[model samples]
Target: MPTRLLLAFALLLASLGVRAAAISYVDEVQPILTQKCVACHTCYDAPCQLNLGSGEGALRGASKQLVYDGTRTEAQATTRLYYDAHGEAAWRRRDFHSVLDAQGGQAALIARMLELGRSNPLPANAKLPEDLDIAITRSNTCPLPGEFAEYASKNPHGGMPFAVTGLTDGEYATLTQWLQQGAPVQEQALTPTAAELSQVEAWERFLNAPGARENLVSRWIYEHLFLAHLYIEGGDQRHFFQMVRSRTPSGQPIDPIATRRPNDDPGTTFYYRLWPIQGVIVHKTHITYPIGSKQLERVRQLFFASDWTVDAVPGYGAQRRANPFETFAAIPAQARYQFMLDNAEYFVRTFIRGPVCRGQIATDVIRDNFWALFQDPAHDLYITNAEYREQATPLLAMPGQFDDIGDLLGLWRNYRDKRNEYEDLRRDTYAAAPLPGWSTIWTGNDNALLSIFRQHDSASVRKGLLGEIPQTIWLLDYPLLERTYYQLVVNFDVFGNVSHQAQTRLYFDLIRNGAEVNFLRLLPAESRQAYLDDWYQDSGKLKMWLDYTHVDHRTPSALYLPGPDAKRSFAGQLLSRYASLDARPDPINRCSNGRCYREGLKAEQRDVEQRLSRLASRPAAGLKVIEQMPEATMVRVEFADGSREVYSLLRNRAHSNVAFMLGEELRYQPGLDTLTLYPEVLSSYPNFLFNLKASEVEDFVGQMQQVSDAKGFEAITQHWGIRRSHPQFWFYFHDLDARIRETQPIEAGVLDMNRYENL
Candidate 1:
């Protein structure tokens, strides 16, 4: 055909909406983006909200806006040429595909960069496109002397691989070639790695442990244990990201690498990585997060058990081996009165160390420090700092344990013998210390000091209860340290909400032991010391064994999956089935915001409350009467079946300043000195909705105990805030109604269980 005829045919096709050939987006554009852009242009804090992390992010073309708000950032980024041409949102909306066809013009950022070595049209120190008051359309208007000059002058990426030197000829060619060929992301399985083979193998054994199902070492527990940050690279089938320990075993520092995997398998994809998370356990995986297991076989498998056998748990002994609930479970439900009276600080710190994260932070600081390993065996650790020394004295008995100003203060009495600084036998030099207490231990490598600390097996929990908190309790109690403590009791927060706005009804009373702990915590420093000293005066009592009680309350409430975990158990099934996410259907994805989801739960709780309230109809029988005892406050009750029970109460009267416990309802006769704690009979479910507020129990108790009747109950509960929605209300309602019936007995004609129709 003639040239004129060919042109006419192309125009005819254009009229029919047939598009011209363009570079492939996956093949061409993405390569340029992934290499030159994504690193700095991330979500949330990207310079201009131009998220290039994914192909879609790039195509979206800057989901945020530009500002002339005169911020510091605007001033620093001005010298770079990345903002010319495609930098402007309106210019980029024209699309890179058209710019690719145009090849080299001011309209295309990529086109101009590609011309670097080949042809140099942009002049020396050309003005940036965005800098110009007028909109940019093409190249010569902003020419550079050459591509090399362009890199030195403006390419903040230093042209291609933005460095002081700039990209090599071969490297620049590869980028240009990919853009010309079209950027195609090769689709395949995510690659795996053998780097942490021993770790991964341990995980496999743990998952397939002997009796994981019956013992409940299920998928839900694994998700609750650890967290991971990883990703999969596009176009490359073998490139996959995996996590590794932050440092190596040889005391050699190893920066945690974004590791590559060998191959991908469905069973291996998106897993709870067995990376050696940082902590103080030598030859042992120190944290025990899957709460209630007798042996925690799931996580225990990853740890080397030779040094940490059932008989030897390093320092705290096997029975009290580390677990998230190790400290929480050990609390004698009877201790809110018994053992706590012996050592208030010991009891409170032990209680606070219940959570895994807090314990991990505490252990991280003291485990392998100079003092922890080499401190004089019989010497007393001093506290001249006056801040942390006062707070952490309980756990700092060892060398690595004391508060360090990185100076002579944390040093032992024998600093002269080992380090051999003879300047002044007593004095030593110290530098500014690491900020967060967890860091000062020199974690980057296996220093000789850490090795010494590791060998002794001397790690202990850092519950600030017995710990003199250098600052405050903010360090240990989190998730549990929210404002909800005041909210739940005041009944002020929304039904399913977490904030602490006050309302009319309160629902929760604090844990009894927590109440006693807080009472002492609130005392003046000297008074507290005098009180603790007084308790220690009762030598025989202070020496009693730690309560061996064990239990866990946290449960799965939401799905913990990037995609569905096919092996999900009951908790996973419910959460995934009910609370999916934004893009899914109702009942699965469900509810718009957290408040709405909580409201749904609140509604269900209301229904259950109404049903349980009927049980309170009959006159309260088996009600106990509070009787003050010479040794402790006592409550004695006669059952309908002619059995008598007595319970030791920290406070018998309905006082706001006491925490409530199930031990207060134990079966008893007059002669026993012990309360006969039914360790297995758990009164509350320690799930997230409940357990997150563990630290706030005493505060909750004081508010709740102020009123005894329904009016008082409503006032304490913040107008029955949780109603039937929270499981706690069910327990509280039953106990409170029984108390109400006992205190104010109904007439003979009142409701009874027998009055209901028999099926």
Candidate 2:
């Protein structure tokens, strides 16, 4: 009897040991995953769609299709081995009773694998719970509990998404655990979440807000972006397109923010007079077509022509002023005038598309219609173009003795008086309850500035004081044409300089905002022109005007949008046209427009014919043709000893412009007006060149990597804004030659030449 009892005890102990062994992760299961799964499940590219190498990937796969039964026979009972799109293993519960019985048996083993997979860290601030039950309850949901929904409720315009199925329930629970534990990231933080994703959608809606006067924040953002647009157009005042609209502060409810329609034109009034001005400042300028003659004339008369005069005034009292029109002509730089002509021409050509031979007639008619570009010195140009003049009339008159730069004496006084008057309105004992649209008037306070800074780092300003809705440019200074989107600069110290690092962070934010992508995909191709183009178009050309009181304007107002379809269509047409022009065939005779004009009759005719032939051939090309070249295909390194080492393109597949060496030596080759690189080496060494300027080098490393063979030539650009000092960086170049080479001849020679792609 004693022997039998001892045998029973031994059997019980052995059973418990086997059970524990079956459920263990480190001792029992990880070895299986390492041997069978790690081989193909590593890195971003997971073959067989299995990324078992990373912990997160492993758990994510828990609810995915996997081979549960060793036998691959049709007759064998197959299991629902993987999670569904929503990360739920609901199918598993239905098919495998043993798997669902977590209290004991095989269910326990399955639970152990899942728990082990949960060890991976989630993204920063990602909501995670320690209790498995809580995680399960919260998993497979979108808008993530209270956050995004709460945000949406506050801002009626916040269009947030509610459902997200990017990960599985099990993966989310595991991610939550890691996140709640402070996300002990082994590599990078967790991926985007449903709530964060909703925020992105909300951002888009907010970005698309009407830029009408009614929308104050949107207007401020637009004005800031206009600065970038001006940079691209050139700093010339003639080319600057300024949009000016003013309204009483919100509390005064007498004239609602949206009610001050300048010109009655439906187009202009849509954004200017009404609450929809917010949309104008944000998304409307992106709604472009060929330049409108009426609008251009208004802008030109207000800004460009010398002959134009302010009310009751001769030219500037101190200076010997010439007739605005005659003086403009005497400037003798036909290049400027020709740009004006071309802008008007393109506008008419695009809008009035019947006969090619009628260009002279069209030019004559349009020129005559927009004659304000020449300006008559006799009349009060200010009255005719009051819409634009008011934008920057320096609210306070100059005391004549004050210098214009930095501080125009009368300006501050005017601003102060205006502030005092606005303050008095708030104190009105019987001020009516603020109108709904009143909230749109944006006053640049710290909170408003901070909000904008948090959302965007770049903004636009008008060329003069006023033009159209304030236009803002986002994501400037890239190797390619930066997309123009609505954004606002929240802060700028006096000199208008943002650190390069901060600027980069801003760009990162812009990209994350996704407005750049939307604008690029939607804006007209011509909109891609650099600051020089923006300047040229705006300077002295009268095809579009900053009309304050036109009845036929097409710009949308705060009260109404042209509707999504209209906005999209308008934006799409402009972008398509611009894209067409960008890809247009290069002119055979590459001379300045002035020279081509001077060559006269025969030359102009020939050039026109050639352009026509090319236009006919491609049928699809952008208007402005600028060439972009790829980086380099090879690099030859000559060491101090004079022995040269050459790294040639091995596979024409992933060639780039810049090559980073292990420590400090940056190997670069400039060919065909583009930069090319060798293999970039990343390492840590105190004395190495790499370490000295690691931050600078780090900023450009990603750009260098982008130079694979597939994309040869990309545009190089610098940030142009008040906040950024416009630090120049080589575009389409491989290495930072300034650091390694003394002469720095590459920039001087290449400045005028078109950067070409490496073929």
Candidate 3:
């Protein structure tokens, strides 16, 4: 066993193709799962509560209970992976069944499941059999070890990868071999580099600094950024850490305070610490934020350098914790406003993607696609006038204080009345002193303008106004922005009973109305009511409830220009003002007036873009295919030189108004629906994927345009779509993932396929 002899033997084994069993689970096997399995297995909607994002989650195994049950009468016990339980035994005590066999035998459920998929490979290059249900609402068929024989016999297609193509041969072998070896938990500890350690120390010291002002500031920062995957700027980007409240201070082992909400009482003195995040980063929940010496200096300037004093630190009581205005009022309003304006996209994402993994009720309050603009702090009435903020404080109280269903009616009444009073006061203020032109709009930085896209249950937010002009626009000021953060991110409870969820949704309705009304105030007085009527047509009695008449008609907008389409004119003016910050003109859709070409695109890519641009021009009303298309479809064009590019085809469904609580389908206006084409992936959840060769681009576009029925659509899909059962599904997926990482390394993660459509 000398060193030279050992090296020779290793070379001999490699020559004979005898692979060793020392495969790194963290480096190899976990990556396969992340790319192929984690899509449907990470969040609350994870199938059977089986989370495969981490080693701990894999060992914790699966549960029969559903985490997102909407019919529950009371809050369910939280089963957060890292917090609720620590080991296999703790999970077993809570009724979770193991998927791995301790004996390193073939009896392991995971092993058998993989073997089943290998033995019964899906039909190649075809639609999945109807028997295999892959819908998001499908029933959980979590077969236990004893029930595997019956389950497989009944549904042979149901395997580890589920309805999708099975893992690659190499990936299958690596995973099966690891499982056969008792699935040893051989993940290495993610030790920080010296620089990372130094940065962590500096951050912990700054956060745990003594004094009431510092304590209040740290608390505020933590509550806002508890969900952020923070990394030290210019350090290892993959090595992200979370800001956690630990009972132990810096240099000690973190004893994290596992509270339901970030602001919940820790029941002890806690220090903010940087805890290394250990898992595969999933796009659905990953919100990246950078922290460094520069960020530290910026925060100091925004909060500490300013002349402000914290009279006392706020308590974690429900009333005080639920209302940010009440809690952080002592902080200079301009400082707080600018802090969020600096990273408005990150804060907006906290509310849009932070609260629930899948929430139609919460998301349905706003339109599918909208542009959001913020109000400048200097021009914001609430931020400049103390009396206005004092009056609005009581009206801003959020829901979820208590989780009783009986409180819904009473809470609704209280919120409704207070909202009405606040609206009247706002109208009177604006009437007394109208906004001076576009002065109210925050034009400080790129984050001032935002684009939000709702892909049904899930959504995404990106900085800079994107796509064509949207149907609705939000003009948020300091008070409105603060209220949105508290209402959606702080108070929303995914595990709460029906009442809590409903009230959160109800409160957001008011916030949405306020924003839309604020935007309407910028239009000419005569055009305001007409716009409201069009936006809320066929809303029925809900119109009366929403109270659209409260808009400020007495105030004439200083920026008003007389035109038939005032909205379009106003949007054009704003876009012209921020033209420097406009997103890179998309080669596919934005080049309609040009030759549909860009400097970086190759000749073939330019040709493909020109052909595909036709799909974006199809009239929404006559194009029957629009109705059949999924919310988001990623189209990949493979070139002759083996290079490829991906683009997103998003269907922006039109609605009369996003005001109603249920029956969302009734409000759909197919005639007004439109398609937005982006020359890159724009959503975390893609419902379908279509792969075509550069030569086939024109044909694909032609087929898509001619599709008038389900049968015709199926024909088009068979030719161009990468259906779940296609033999090359994994290949296309890996290519798409690589392209995303290459283009957007800082923002990319494994795209979730839970919503990947059967069509």
Candidate 4:
């Protein structure tokens, strides 16, 4: 064919509404799904197990099995993408049905869903219709190809990107065309740059050095960082890797040893290999950890430079695997503590976001918001005294070491006894030494101070104390910190039976109380009991399990500060001490004495920000709407010039105590609730979105204040809320996503809309 004739033929094909070029799944299709679809379709709890975050996930398609089921009597088979099953045939045998038809005989199920959404676009700027159930607990109707037609006929609005805005015409056309052509996917393999390869080689050599000590250190590091998106400092920011235990050695193809837990035995000689992450980074699962020459040197100083010996490499026995102190006993306790403290935020996030994707059962063990302070390694008994570490090692056994349904009560009782013994030993150890004051708190690094916010089922951790003084403060020492990691991150089983899951949740209750009691011991002796009573006010029988009396109130304070409220005074002092390291003051939320401004704030912007900050005030009894507010709401302030700023309005729900696993509603104390305002989104999931013009800011605030009933709330949302039904939702979402990536590139990822409310 001649060039001119070929061009004429291509033009004819284009004129006939035929795509002359094949769609690039990597460049064209995946990006569309990431922005519009993946938010609700990623992670363990992805609706109907349809994870569109990767090509394999799409090919594997949807399943009716619920990953977040808490009622199962037996452990479910793990179906993790890329790990549990290899290819489409394997997934099909595991009961997954394809959403895309490869033969192209029938319109693919996904194509049909998208068309149904387009044909019956949602009503604009209003609450979603009652028929469209968007609740997190709503039953999933995972229709296969044969059932999709009947499914769509009954529920016209039930489509891909369900209850949200339909895709743009261009996006829809591109996706439909690709599905029409058998949904062919041409995925490009991730190639590491020369620098990245060099770094990987260097790290692998360091981790796999020919020595038992080196092997033990590598095992410890891999267990702690298995979930991390590891990257070498000064390398490409987009490229990230996971440190996996592989049967094949370095330089060979990575044959990952897929175990339920990071510490599970590989059943063969294994090497630590860096596996490049080959999927879109979702905020809920992305945890970034940087390694470089400096980090490597630091590790050497912490583990190798110290005068310590690894008597023998530890086995992956259940008892040793469940106790880090036992497994890594040869490593200096101070070295281990310092390593974790260096990246406290990342470690905290590992347990908070790592184990279970949608974990209300696990998360309900904590208060809605709290400040976390670490005890200095110098003062921490477990770090400084080998005797204390030895005594606490055997007592540190955690639940889920064995996932047996019959052992539920037995495990709980056994753990409870060990916890009691450990508590007594801890109190005696502290009493034997002079009671330290604020000096006991860790101040070696910026990670010394942290703020943890539980946004309902999901949570976030940030360095440096944030927001107003929280209801509870945790003062963690070495043992407490290491146990937290072992119990939650290493031992938690997302696919475990109800018994295993319940035991994990129940055990964390003891950990939370122990940390809280540590903080209470620092307060005035008279005030210690009062604080515990208030924190555990309505706990009926659970108080026995909490064992609040174990707190040593007889110990006198070494330093005295004169104040009516000693707890508040101490927290304020701690906050001021680290204020220099606090994250840059959020322009919207940082207000004092009726003034609000950051270095770059304009006078007009400052005025609006100061006024908006008033919404952060503690809600009075009459502000009934505060009780109804979602966990997180992103408020966008649009200026007349079209420039806008986004802020998060967090509803910090108060509770008598987060003790009871169930009956969370009964524990809610709405009158004591408060709201926190931040300059940008602080949560991975935003429940509602409100867009207001700079001029309408006051009206928006006024209406929010006056809203007392659901009707009034609806009125406010009808006027200002960017409901999923809004035609411009994608525009707002894209803007928010771009802004986050621009401002916090390393930490930013696609915000999840799985919890986006119908209103």
**Which numbered prediction scores highest in TM-score against the true structure?**
4
Per-candidate alpha-carbon RMSD to the true structure: 31.3, 27.3, 4.1, 3.4
Q: Roughly what TM-score does model 4 have, to 2 decimal places?
A: 0.95
TM-score of each: 0.24, 0.18, 0.94, 0.95
Runs off by more than 4 Å, candidate 2: 1-569, 577-759
How many angstroms is residue 185 displaced in model 4 relative to the true structure, after the best TM-score fit?
1.0
For model 3, what is the error of residue 283's alpha carbon versus the real structure, in angstroms, after optimal superposition? 1.1
Error of 1 at 508 (Å): 21
Clashes of 3: 0
lDDT agreement of model 4 with the native: 0.82
* Residue-by-residue lDDT tens digits, candidate 1, 1-759: 654455455556556866545545555555444444443344222333444544434433332232212122211111111222323353455332222322333323443444442233222222223332211111112222233345435533223221112233443444444444433333222223443343345544554444423123323223222222111212122222223322232223333322111111113213333343221111111212211132335234423222322321122321221111222222211211221122222222222222111121122212111111111111111212324223322221112111233332324333212212211111111112211122211121111011101101112222111110111111112111111121121112111111111111111121111122222322232333443333222321232112111111121112222333211232233234323221112221122242211124344332322222221111122211111111121122233444322221221111111111222223222221211111011111111011113223344334433333454533433421322223242232233223423432220001111000000
Model 3, 41-129: lDDT tens digits are: 99888999999988888889899888887778888878888777778999999999898774333368888888788778878877777
Stretches of candidate 1 off by over 4 Å are 1-36, 47-174, 187-190, 193-205, 208-221, 224-226, 229-298, 301-759
lDDT by residue (tens digit), candidate 4, 1-759: 654455456556756877667878999999999989988888988999999988999999999899988899988899889898888999999999888884336778888888788788877877788877788888888888888779988988888778898787677767866786679876556789899999899888998888888888888898889989988788887889999888888899998888988888888888898999887888888889998888988998898887778778988878877677888888888888999999988898888766367868668999988889888888898887878878988888777777678777888888888888998998989888878787888887777788888888998887766677788999988778888888888888888889988888888888898899888778888788778878887673467544433678798877575688878888767656767766644434434545654566776667667767767756547567787789888998888777788888888888888877788889888887887787767788889999998888888888888888888988988999999988899788666777778777877777789898987
Compared with the true structure, the alpha-carbon lDDT of candidate 1 equals 0.25
Q: What is the lDDT of residue 509 in candidate 4?
A: 84
Superposition error at 383 for model 2 (Å):
8.2
Query: Stretches of candidate 4 above 4 Å error?
Result: 1-19, 102-104, 540-542, 545-549, 584-592, 596-600, 620-622, 640-642
